[model samples]
Target: MVQSLARAGCEVTLVLKAPVRTGRLVDPLRGLPGVTVHSPHAAGRIPDHAVMVPRWAAGVLAELDEADPFDLVVVRGRQIAAKLAAGPLAGRLWTYLTDVPQHPAEFTGAAFGELRRIADASRMLLCQTEELRCFMESAVPATAGKSVLFPPVVALPEGLEPRAEGAPAGRALKLVYTGKFAPRWNTYEMTRLPARLTVDAEVHMIGDKVHVDPGDPGYAPRMQAALESAPGVVWHGGHPRAEAMRLTAACDVGLSWRHPSLDSSLELSTKLLECGLLNVPVVLNRTPMHERLFGADYPLFVATEDDVADALDRVAKDPELYALAAARCRAAAEDYTLDASSARLAGYLADAFPAADEKVLAAGGGRKLRVGIAGHDLKFFTRLLDYLNSRPDMEVRVDHWSALRVHDPAKGEELLDWADVILCEWCGPNALWYAERKRPGQRLLVRLHRFELYADWPRKLAIDNVDKVICVSPHYRDLTLAKTGWPSDKVVVIPNWVDDKQLDRPKLEGAEHHLGFIGLAPSRKRFDLALDVLEELRRDDPRFTLFVKSKLPWDYWWIWQKPEERAHFEEAFRRVRRSPLLSGGVVFDDYGRDVAAWLRRIGFVLSTSDDESFHLAPAEGMAAGAVPALLNWPGADTIYDTRWIHRSTTEMAQSIADTVRLGRWDADRRDGRAQVRAAYGLDEVCAQLVDALAGHAPADLGPAMMR
Candidate 1:
């Protein structure tokens, strides 16, 4: 169970029972990825080959002091659970009951009394069958809602045996049974089954005489005598479990029969699932449980000798019927395989430890809040995550589109269910996904920056379900409200964060006239206007030069795909190459590491974009103590102070030259850096986000937008 669960990507920690009868499996269990094996002390001081039981209470109790908390704790019975209740993790307890005696005659103080106590204390009762669960609920009414059916599961064999080159062609239909023959099972009925068959049939009984009671020593001899009298019966004594499966594979059909009077109607036969998984059909006594699992039309449901004979004869008469029955059995077995069982178990455990809905942090003690971030581009948010990481109460999880933009719906659902609060970065597909799938008690926030306003994302996204729709600036907030009809109360304006710590580095000598522009390739960024600013500044002093810090325009797919845009940049770049005033004077520094150092080389930063919600380059440059020469973009006054905003490209160029000439640039530089630090420092921005996430309104939530 642990191995299969671990293989399915779950972290499994197994607390093994004593002496670990798991001799050969112990090493294999330890080697599986994400699987941890712990051994509890045995029941005795001395080694006893017989009756090895766990004296695990001491070891388990000691482990509780140091080990990390578990989402669930599953024990076998009352005494063990009672022992574990002494620890701090008592709340995460569950119990799996095995071989429960449901009959009133077996209800001694040792059985029913102990079971009732465990049922009352446990968080849930995991049982082997629905029949067993119903009986348990009636016997202990406190366990009524807790009981769940945990059916028997079989591992599908990995390797199949290759048949001999010329194996026998027209042989009898060979039947097999690979379990002990106790008298209660009515095993003597198998001796006459061969005679009742219409087709030539043989029965192979392979097992040790394990059913012989100490009081009835003659039982083994009697069974041997009955087997010898049976026609076409091959008796193979005692084989290992794996060998028995292999032996069953080399047969035509597996057989298991019992009278329904002995509580057999309520119980399941493990052999039925085993044979079904091997693609071998079985003939079992007609019962309601089997009918529900294998379907009512399954050809092998039988009761007496005549019914058993009829089921087999029908399969033998037509090859298609036999093939169809075998296929049906394999399909039925799919739900009972180990892989299927582990997945269901994982889901149960997930529900047992659901993500907390409320995210209030109590006084004194700290908590790790599950912060989920969903987005298309993670670059902006990822840079600011370090600030949140410094806090004692936050744990961040990032979700993005998978490779090739192929979304896994199930994986997305798991992340949604696991988070206390989800922050969607853009108002695109990712935001729409959370909007549609957000659960009832979960807090969901979507961030709308500039680009999403042009795309149809804002119109398609369901903002009514969102707790908050954050905009990077007040201008975008007003624009988004005007365009999308979002509730005005939910609209918030939190500025984009800039890492102030990464700035304030040492500047290079003679860099006062080295004007810098970042991200020049985009047509909307208006590099031509910035170059015009450079053209004006260069008329006085040839020392003035333009420094561009951006990705080469040709490398960007979005820019290169449009022929007009590409030619526009190509012509601009050619002019820079042709004129001596712009030729060797203009420096094209490709995008690289050390952004802080790159910003330090330039005395002034230019923002000549046609439009922007909250331009971050100026904020980053201001933090580096550079003067920002701006050609007023639409809403530029909202992002920066009006002193920095200019009316045209000529005005921006004059401001740059006048600042350097008057030597008043130092005061402007000092104030600009302080202004940026006050408005959009990384720490304050992260706190605003976490406050909203923890279900609180930060004092700094932006100016209210009226509908």
Candidate 2:
């Protein structure tokens, strides 16, 4: 979480317990840029309890006072949390509750009072799951609105893959149990799993005997004895977290079936997720929590020892089943990664702290660009804004002309005067408005994406005020030249930006058969062509499915406004609805945030748009190792090689089939990825924009102003 915050460009100071036993966790964080690890070293003995907590908190506060007021105080351990919550940092607190007490009903005296104080003081409570969140909220109704589901975080290990079920025939399926062996975990049941199983099994237990309390001396001994007596079990003494994960990765299933002490509905074991992170399937007791995290189809859930035996038998009988389960488990584990969970944490922190992201770094570009960007809908140009923000030399301000003042001249004039250069996205009345009020030296750059070409806005644009017209594609530039009658020299083609780094990912198995399309509903986008390609592919192989990453077509009234256009889409929709092959095979996934992960499930991405400025979705998919099957368009050749482009739907289908069968798919994927990296990288596009801006600038500003 610290690393994620630091990476997201936040200053982080990690406060740990005194006499820090620095190892794998602390050392790496200490080395990260913008990270400071502050552990208070004791001057003398200071016992941790209510007596010293106030004094200790004061000292901690004194240390924190040296810096500006902390945006958010992330209090981790339960012992020190109450003290921190009650202290000066009460309001900006986000209490992380990792280990909930098993006996919450017994909370009384100081414990109950402290718990209430912490819950009341905190801005938000972090729970591992919604189930746990509900449990905490029920226990303290004061926490109901504040708590957020903070899932278990395990960073994806590099070069780590789930154990493939390719072991030699009749090889024993290894079941590993590694975590706390306290009574609630049913450690004895886990140890007995191998003996109860009909299939050959080996249960390797690796964890420390958890000490619940100093008074309960008998608990650890009894648990350890039960583990030792169990047949077909090997008890390895506790290893460090990293080593345990490494050992667990070599096993087949992570074992965690136990007696449901307390409401099992609320319990979500982190170790099972740890196994999941390592791509090891889990043999867990079926619970509502488990079902929510892992879909109902998760085959390894066990109700009893006999059920455990049956699950083992079922997996052993078909190794492929184990492989598929492992794959699905690995897939499910992506959502719970440390980086993924930290985004949620960052959001809570942003709400609490508010100014962390806006905090400026000391060193920046010598002269800020003072770039004013005006747009009606900036949906297409968000990447451009991101690029401008990343550069220290650029300071950007945006005005939404459509949302604020649909036809107001005063607001547009104010925007034009604020900027040295004003770039209008979606060249319509917005461009015309900018062009009308531009000063002598001020530069105007208008970018025209595909949708605006058909609109009546092009002819109305004041070409004289516009110093440069940025087209997403060369074809759009030519079409705009004919429509607006702008001189050839005034227009330039800068491709749509693609962050190549995010797009590159490890492709999943059977992805080659998965066909993906980004937008499905639009008629001009030619979503039906994608279906046609999928149908053609399925004739040869049933595995083919067109995965349409889209918003619902009904949401956009523009596509249905024209009766003929609506009928065309309706016929296609009818075909998809009527045919079993088209209906089941056409997968509709709403446009998602994690495009890179979605790309991993697809082997080929289709750009079947009848008209396009630049088809970025296929390029993004290709960057993630998916082969591009592009439909021929005016500017298609300028972006991709002719080999990947097809003149017709049949040609596109044939191209996909040939690429798969003749082993050109991998090579084509590589070529498409390389093309995107070379042409549409943020740095590459930024340079082009800078150079163009420099060319249009007056001689007063030197070439240094270009970047």
lDDT of candidates 1 onward, in order = 0.72, 0.71
Evaluate model 2: give its TM-score: 0.62
Off by over 4 Å in 1: 18-22, 40-69, 77-89, 104-110, 161-169, 213-218, 227-229, 263-265, 355-707
How much is 623 displaced in model 1, in angstroms? 58
With a 3 Å backbone cut-off (N, CA, C), the pairs that clash in candidate 1 are none
Q: List the residue pairs that clash in candidate 2.
A: none
1-707: candidate 1 lDDT, tens digit per residue: 67556755577777655567656667767888898776544535324454323334535644643567665566766557655555554545677777567676667877766676666666667777655665566565556545665677886444765222221238888888878877656676776677888788888888876477577787677777767767878888788666788888788777876665753545577787888888787777666567667777888877777787888888877777777677766787787788888776776554444333334443112467777887767767864553454344667777776531456777679888888788888778888888999888777888887878989888888887788988888888889889988778888877788777547644555567888888887788888888888888888877888899889878899888999889879888888888666766788876753456577678888899988888888888888888887877777788888888899888887888888899877788888888888788765676577667776764348632111
Output the number of the lDDT-best candidate: 1
Write down the lDDT that model 2 would get: 0.71
Residue 429's lDDT within candidate 1 is 86
In the range 1-707, model 2's lDDT, one tens digit per residue, is 68667765678888655565556677878888999887555333344322345457556765675567776676776767777776777766778876555456755667667766888887668777655665565565566546776766777455666555453255777888887776666676677777777777888889776656466678777667766776778788888877788788888888777775533546466677777778788777767566656767788887777787888778777778787667667777887777787676675554343221111221112355667888778877765675565455557788777552385566667777777778888777778777888888787888887667888777787887788888876667778888878887787777777767546655655788899988776687887778888888888878888887778677789866878778778888898899766768887775645565567789988888876777888777867889888888777776777777888989888878887889877887887777777777755676667555545323221111100
Error of 2 at 658 (Å): 2.1
